[model samples]
Target: MNGVRGLLGVAVCTGLAGCAAETGYADLEAYLDAARTQATVQLEPAPTLRPVPTLSYGASALRSPFQLPVGASVADRQGAAVPGMNDPARVREPLEGFDIEQLQMVGTLSGTAGSFVLLRGGGVVYRLRIGDYLGRDQGRIVAIGDSRVDVVEVVPDGAGAWLERSRTLALKTHS
Candidate 1:
């Protein structure tokens, strides 16, 4: 029995020695060495930052947005009263009942006597000359041209004063 055990132990030792001498990992080790030599590791460069421009706001001298518009009454702004602005005793004319915007210049009549402007308002035609009063706001005709009539009106400025406003009534051309 001791001799049989010695032979089995010697056979096991011989099989292990043969396996150690012929290892199958030689190809795998060669492939790993080749891959390591061909491999590369690179890092990208860091980015650069630019400086921002400094801007200064320049609207300190302008009017504030929270305040009202820069406008005052004619009497308050001018610091004086307009002479002969609105006469209360003046007689009203036929066209004084209508607004100046409602009157339309239809035609112009020029004769040996003087030139006249024909206006149509409220389905009625009227012949107006320079210095004639019209419109509800005491508008006096100042010029009567061939295609238009200009008037100066005295209107309240909402500050217990009157201001002269120029209005033009253009001629009505039929298509």
Candidate 2:
């Protein structure tokens, strides 16, 4: 038994020494050293932005820049009554309740009475003529042509004044 134990101890010590003396990792160690020397990274500085300049608007006393320019005549500016103003006593027309854009010119008619235009709105067809009022904006028909109907509309100019503007309703062409 003593001899067997002594041989086992010698074998263990010899195996440990053999493992420590081995040089199988020489290439791995050289590669690591070369990589450490070659590895390098460069960083760039961040960009800086300039501040925007501030401006102050001081046109409160003058006319507003956003409001439409008032083209009222001198008489109108002098407190005279403006033409095309809605009359309170006049009866409103059925087509006046509809917008000019909503009414499509469907056809035209000419007879002994006068020239007339047929307009369709809200699933109903209405006959109109020059001087007839239509649209919610107090629009009055001024002319009826073969392909379009011209109307003069009274609209507020954003300055407590009313202005007359021309609007055209084109005839609906079948697709």
Candidate 3:
């Protein structure tokens, strides 16, 4: 009876050990399967964030109809050098300088000379000659297209007094 009881005790202990081992094996298999599935989850690069498409209040406004405000402060985004950095007060000379302050065309230098005469402030101030040295474009009396203009040139016919004369200075435009 002692031998049988000892054998039964040993058998019971062995069965419990087997059961625990089986359970441990099953837990390990489950853990391995979970790890493999996670490894094969197919990870890809993250998508980039894009700007949203938006509309303005006046979507049809292609260009500004008004001119930009003068002396307005503006930030230069592009790294371009400022133009005309040499001269700040440089300005191109005008063609003719004559004030209409009670000014009248007296006469040019020569009678057939293509010059302009301007009487300003009750005096003959400028007798703009055709080939008078000036700035860029040479000042010349030419018929602009087909416009009829009346100009006057002074004729010094060996006379002491320069007689006030009239000549046509026309500047016509093509239609």
Candidate 4:
């Protein structure tokens, strides 16, 4: 009885091994080939590059930074009243020490005598009127309007003669 049972177990194992060997993988191979045919691959085109532009620098048209600004001389022209030109010997005013661009017309004041322009600069407010001097370029107040102060500045034209230029200092409005 023991020998018969052992023989039956060996026969069942042999039958399973034979069935596994006969099984085919053709269906799996056909599925993988179909997936590869249906798949698509895309590649982008390369970007075009532009050439850099060449710049030409001309020094003749540019002003010299080492020298004083254009029309900075205060020498009097051959024949002109040039109010501030002949005043070199006189005492310089307090506001004359600062540049014209640094000063700002903040507001105005009126008194019994006349109206005065209020200039603020260097952390201090200054009251000035017509004929008063301000700015390093011998700038003199000529007219005071409602919102602006007109001034005549005498500056050198890079030569021995001086030139008079009109400048306006407007009241600053804050937002």
| Best-fitting candidate, scored by TM-score | 2
Q: What is the clash tally of candidate 2?
A: 0
Instruction: Determine which window of 10 residues in candidate 3 has minimal summed lDDT.
Output: 133-142
* Tens-digit per-residue lDDT, 1-175, candidate 4: 9999999999999999998884688899899999899958677878888898998888968887756567664443355565647666888889999999999999888889899999987989999999999999999999998899999898876646678889999999871
Alpha-carbon runs more than 4 Å astray in model 2: 1-40, 46-78
Writing each residue's lDDT as its tens digit, candidate 1 over 129-166 gives 89898998888888989888899988876556567899
The residue-by-residue lDDT of candidate 3 on 1-175, one tens digit each, is 9999999999999999987774547788989898887856668989998999997787465545443335532232123332322235744223334322233334334345443543223343444443332212212332211233243333332322233244453332231
Global Cα lDDT for candidate 1: 0.83
| TM-score, model 2 to reference | 0.61
Q: How far is candidate 1 from the true structure (C-alpha RMSD, Å)?
A: 17.7
For each candidate in the order shown, give its overall lDDT on alpha carbons: 0.83, 0.85, 0.42, 0.85
**Cα RMSDs of all predictions?**
17.7, 11.7, 26.5, 14.1
Query: Clashing pairs in model 3?
Result: 108-152, 108-153, 108-154, 144-172, 146-172, 147-172, 149-169, 149-170, 151-167, 151-169
* Deviation from native of the Cα of residue 14 in model 2, angstroms: 44
Greater lDDT among 3 and 4 belongs to: 4
Residue 89, model 2: Cα distance from true site in angstroms? 1.2
* Collision count for each candidate, in order: 0, 0, 10, 1
Task: In candidate 4, list every pair of residues with a backbone clash.
Answer: 73-156
Worst ten in a row by lDDT for model 4: 73-82
Ranking by TM-score: 2, 4, 1, 3
